[model samples]
Target: MTRPKISQMEAYMIETLRASGVTNEAIIQAAKEKDVSTWKQINDQYDFEQLLVLAEQDFSTFEEIINDGYAVKFVTVGGLERLLKLKFQKVEGKDFQKLKTGVQGLDLSGSSLDELKQMLSINWKITKNNEYVSVLLKEKKDFA
Candidate 1:
């Protein structure tokens, strides 16, 4: 059987994954699992954009990626900043200052979600196990 030809975008994605330290075999496996027949198909079938973002990250370990339910990793200072913005809206003010003070001069690039939660004053929990890490918000009660 002849292998299907990959498009330029597919090639780019593969190269990006490879450059990010993904083994060629792993890339091929991922492509096969997605049944990626063309570049356009890849976008339709997978979170191609997210994958691109992950490629730019510098995750401390592959286990982190595997443990992250979204298969996403944030391993760069910029990536950490983006995550904070997404989760907290504004990365400024007292809460931000508290966070900064908590982790002052510390390297967060390779920190786990649980570790991050511990460093902040957020009322969220990191439900991390051998399988994955999930962030859950605490329920708020209405006071009379």
Candidate 2:
């Protein structure tokens, strides 16, 4: 990853860890080790609570997007992850029906299909009815 991307991910991780009541010392340690692998380790170890919080926030944002009839075409891994989380939650069939109701559709782009699949822990057999989210495995040049 590039320096700025690493920095952004670091900042995001720090904010997430802080929100989840992680200790300042741990945060400092994470900050001291600034690299993609280290960040992934920190995220894997500490991102559960924050991911739930972010998923809720993303759901609210999606609600607004649907309300205002916004045609969303998100071109970021974060966006794709948000959608995937919602989709996974919905598939789990636990108090997530409200998300699919009155929804048109959205386009979600990520770095690679394989990369995103690797991030998923569960086997999600998403069907056509659950096609509210359209996936776009975008090349790096498209982002540039």
Candidate 3:
């Protein structure tokens, strides 16, 4: 069967839900319901209002990131570029000078949340904003 054609925004929302630990079965059931109960589930588990705001902000930004053409990799607000910067922050003993000229990027999809936080080097909290970022970081298959 053919897959349903979803907009970038819809995909973003689905991914965000997945990252926030919403099971695919639950999401599918919610979509089937297509009613207030679906929303209630989200509101019960998270700050739904805040999630909407972050999703709106990330919608267009996510499009731009996809167009950069690094394959189907996901990232937060800063996107792939930001992810790359964080991944390479460690200058270490190998080829710092070569890295200065140019560096091959690693596949960031494999990074765990803890690893991502370490790369970001901030007092990372699991906020709505972070949840949206996690959306981009998650594989599309997660929603499928």
lDDT of each: 0.37, 0.35, 0.36
Residue 86 accuracy (lDDT) in model 2 = 36
Task: Give me the displacement of residue 59 in model 3, in angstroms.
Answer: 24
Scored by lDDT, the top model is 1
Candidate 3 positional error at 31, Å: 1.4
Question: How much is the lDDT of residue 69 in candidate 3?
Answer: 16
Residue pairs of candidate 1 with colliding backbone atoms: none
Q: Candidate 3 has which clashing residue pairs, if any?
A: none
Candidate 1 yields a Cα-based lDDT of 0.37
**Candidates 1 and 2 compared by TM-score, better number:** 1
135: Cα error in model 3, Å: 18
lDDT of 1 at 60: 30
Highest-TM-score candidate: 3
Q: List the RMSD of every prediction in angstroms.
A: 16.1, 14.2, 14.9
lDDT string for model 2 (1-144, tens) is: 111111223234544554555555553333334222433544576443433343244544423322221222222444334433433322222322323221124322343333334332222222223434433344456455
Poorest stretch of ten by lDDT in candidate 2: 1-10
